[model samples]
Target: MMGWLWAVQVILFAAGTGLGMSDARRKSTEVRLPLWVRMLISLTLTAAAFALWRDDPASSSKEWIFWGMAWSFIGDLSMAGIIPWRHPMIGGMLTFAVAHVFYIAAFAAALHHEGLDLMNAGLAVVAVFYGLVLIAAWLLLIRNPDAPRLFNIGSLVYGLWIGAMASAAAAMAWSLGGALWLTAVGGLLFVVSDTIIGAAAIGGRLLRHQGYWVWLTYVAAQMCIVYAFTL
Candidate 1:
């Protein structure tokens, strides 16, 4: 089952996190570039996703997860400026948004696999709250004088994608319970990380080590989502 890959990922994740936290310490106003260490970690996760999907060749959800992770790897590269693009920042945002679409697909597939309905009173409440919060946050980001109009628009669009991903994961976890809760945790953590970035965009500068907050939560999010599924 390629279980040893988990150990490899763990080692890489720890190393990357340490480097990211160290690099983040001095970045006050600007977000740190997506460094090679982080990109290597992302690539490892993508490979892990593929291994998982290969293990469950019949599972549609696993297939979606693999694609999602692949797109995420591409997004990391785009953000790192390793990929050629006229505007790397916006390209990375849009690419990451596309990855969320695959995650939404994976959640939908998981729901179907579990024979659970996506619509329910409890999940509706959670979904509604997420929607309202996103709306308010989007308005705030767009109105910020410091952020460019294009960046604001991209953030709003990306925020909606992540919101949908979170809602889908929440519905799956709420219905299934148990280890699936990690998936929900991952989704929510992703929102937390992204929200920090958005807040920084609005306020110009965040507390010291802004990248540390963002990177730690984000890595946790990705780890939670992929491993929880195997569990």
Candidate 2:
């Protein structure tokens, strides 16, 4: 039963990606995916993923990451709905921000289970990278006159939290030499996807060019995270 549920979840996610691609492929047409349909599919897949560890989640770190992935699923659906209505842009960004926070919590919990020290050389490198991201986000906000103040801030907060979470995971020391590396990679991919989305939103870049790149990155990010949880 667990195996079948997992298989179905993957198929659902794959179909979602195919839908996203189809949306991208239809150029010169104002084709947007049905908001409710996507939401329902995403939510159902998430629930199925969670069912794997429903019996004993505390004993399975993979389950914890799946919970975080569920948050991310919700965020992705909200963000996809934002521009179509234009009324929920801020709400969507906030949802995604909260989702990243959940991811941070999951990563931190995994690191704790590994008994990894917070202060380390890898962490220091990530700290420097994180500082650069902050400065870059600040610069983007300062220079962009059309950017919404609140959503821009929300993007920054999301980026910072995700960076910290990825850093923590990367530096963690596991007892058996491997610990949630897939999750860490997934988190990093999500950071890239979100960063691109934020830049496209504020900088007015990538609009004139191809639209598929943006959505592709978004799909890739989500798929990576999903696979991470299953791994």
Candidate 3:
């Protein structure tokens, strides 16, 4: 039954991905899952995170992911506008940023075992790498002052944090190649997912099939991260 639980999660994620892609593929679709149902499918994130606790909740790294994923679930609802907050978008942004903080901490913890020099070198590579991405977002969102800009202020800070998270995860992969590579992959996917979201939100509209790509990358990102640690 425990193993079956993971299978069920895969099923839910696949179903949710299909529904989301279908909805986003074309506006002319005669049928669609309600927005709330689509958002609820994200509960699988929480469930998978919970399963990670089977190893050792006392471990700081595991605990961080546990809480991080919990925040991510809330973020999903907030972004979907299912939460009753007056400013659900802001709430989602804040919650997901917090989630990244926890993930950064967890990733950093894992890399601490390696020498500080190696870890720092790896992180520096990504920090510098993501600067180009940051510059691009600024260029795109500059024209639309009215639209939400994830490149601005608090969102900018959040972007950097996730960049740092990516750096840490990459450092781990470099120093200890194996399942840690999945962590690196997950981190990169996260950055990609968020970049797509920021671009669309800043433009005030999703590009053709952009929503499908967003959900697909986001789900895959979380799954990779979870599976990396669990492995």
Which candidate should be chosen as best, given TM-score against the real structure?
1
Give a tens-digit lDDT track for model 2, residues 92-142: 666666666665555556556667555677667876786687558546632
Local error of candidate 1 at residue 207 (angstroms): 3.3
Q: Ten residues in a row with the worst lDDT in model 3?
A: 29-38
How well does candidate 3 score on lDDT at residue 63? 74
- Give the distance in Å from residue 116's predicted Cα in candidate 1 to where it truly belongs: 2.2
Please give the lDDT score at residue 213 for candidate 2: 47
Q: How far is candidate 3 from the true structure (C-alpha RMSD, Å)?
A: 3.2
* Model 1: worst 10 consecutive residues (lDDT sum): 25-34
**What shift in Å separates residue 205 of candidate 3 from its native position after superposition?**
5.5
TM-score of each: 0.87, 0.72, 0.83
After superposing candidate 2 on the true structure, give the runs of residues whose Cα lies further than 4 Å from its correct spot. Answer: 1-41, 60-63, 82-87, 137-143, 173-179, 207-215
For model 1, which pairs clash?
none
Model 2: lowest-lDDT 10 consecutive positions: 171-180
RMSD versus native structure for model 2: 4.1
User: How far does residue 26 in candidate 2 sit from its true spot (Å)?
Assistant: 5.7
Each prediction's whole-model lDDT (CA): 0.78, 0.57, 0.71
Task: Identify the leading candidate in terms of lDDT.
Answer: 1
- Candidate 3: tens digits of C-alpha lDDT, residues 135-163: 56645642256754543555566666777
